[model samples]
Target: MKDTGSAQDAEHEVTMLKVISDLDADLNNVVKFHERVDMSLYDLLEQREWEHHPLHEIRPVAKQGLGVLHTDIKPDNIMFVNMKDQPLRVKLIDFGLAKMASQVELGMEIQPCGYRAPEICLGLPFSKAVDVWGVGCVLAFLYLAQNLFSFKCEYQMVFII
Candidate 1:
């Protein structure tokens, strides 16, 4: 892919990063400590590879416009919650930019500043992958103690990433 100039889709990369993190944690179960607090990874990926099931889980978004998304998946949205007789739980909230997959037309930019993915910047069609990017970004944040792919002013963030 050619180098697309500027931050047209600034937050696009953020969600993809989150996806990567989720995969990493699920595959490796490698936990990292941030500020002495145990930051558990997202438990999204299934232990078994997704096979064709009689009743598949992933279905096309309904025409009524209601798909799955926690659009603005930044660190702030990742809240640590407490439950009865259970360890700390992670809750992802703030679906400000969320939209049904069927409703998500191509070229509609999303995510927060500094987390834009390349596809978003390039104005390509996006889907559930955006959430993965967000989760991967969160995992990176936990490990790096800083925003890994956050662009400040220019698009240098992409180069570094």
Candidate 2:
């Protein structure tokens, strides 16, 4: 029974490798794989189109248009969905911390320590720009495969930044 299981595992591994190789060969320019499927803000930035979802206009950054401040923009909050045949699409999840641009207050604690913007860290008045900062951190993490500023504490994060 042990030998049979081992053989099956080996066979599956080979099959996976072959599939990966075939995929690599098929795409001359395979986008670098990120856990979030390499989703970029380019489309959101350049197109500046907003979906009619119940959520806010969801524009890129601030002052560009009406947008919500996804205060906790992190890799874990991003998900690739609708992947069955169509090009990969991502949806920002976990809006528990989200606030409208007009609703956000000064010195309100938001965003993870590492992704927190300097203004947020310093208890200064902040706006949707903090969300942009969080997105920048997420982008850095996706590209580098690790947190751009990995720190155990907010002080360390602020110092590193």
Candidate 3:
């Protein structure tokens, strides 16, 4: 006999990253970290030229890619599971807020409370880095056992603005 939920959970678990590869961002005319921060840091990325990249020929949403962005990456979505006779493995769960990395705009709000990334918080166009940022927040929580930027609400997360 086999367990049904185990099989379902195995299929349902969201892999942290389906693939891993070395990647680099355009630096010649980067959005300049400070520049992005300088803009209305409190506005949603979609409200501004969030796609302002260094490439003059390529618009932000031009080259649609195959990567998936998990905009909502709270601690509850990550968990460690141990299967019988198998080593324990950590996995990311939930795809409710997942979106194509190349999506120009989403009707639904991205990210949740304290786990929101800077780009998401500012309504700035974002990429895979948003997921990385969320994971970094998770790592910080695991390391320190406390929320880094504890906020009662998403609107309350304006540390810069």
In TM-score terms, which candidate is top? Answer: 2
Off by over 4 Å in 3: 1-66, 83-88, 104-108
Clash pairs detected, candidate 3: 43-122, 44-123, 45-123, 45-124
State the lDDT at 66 in candidate 1. Answer: 18
Per-candidate TM-scores read 0.54, 0.57, 0.52
lDDT by residue (tens digit), candidate 2, 36-132: 3434433332233422222132221112111566676765655444344433345554444556577778888889888899999899998778877
Better of 2 and 3 by TM-score: 2
Task: Please give, for residues 60-161, the per-residue lDDT of candidate 1 as tens digits.
Answer: 100011135546666565543333332334444444455556667778767775566666666797777776776666656554545778557426756765
Off by over 4 Å in 2: 1-66
Task: Provide the lDDT at 133 for model 2.
Answer: 85
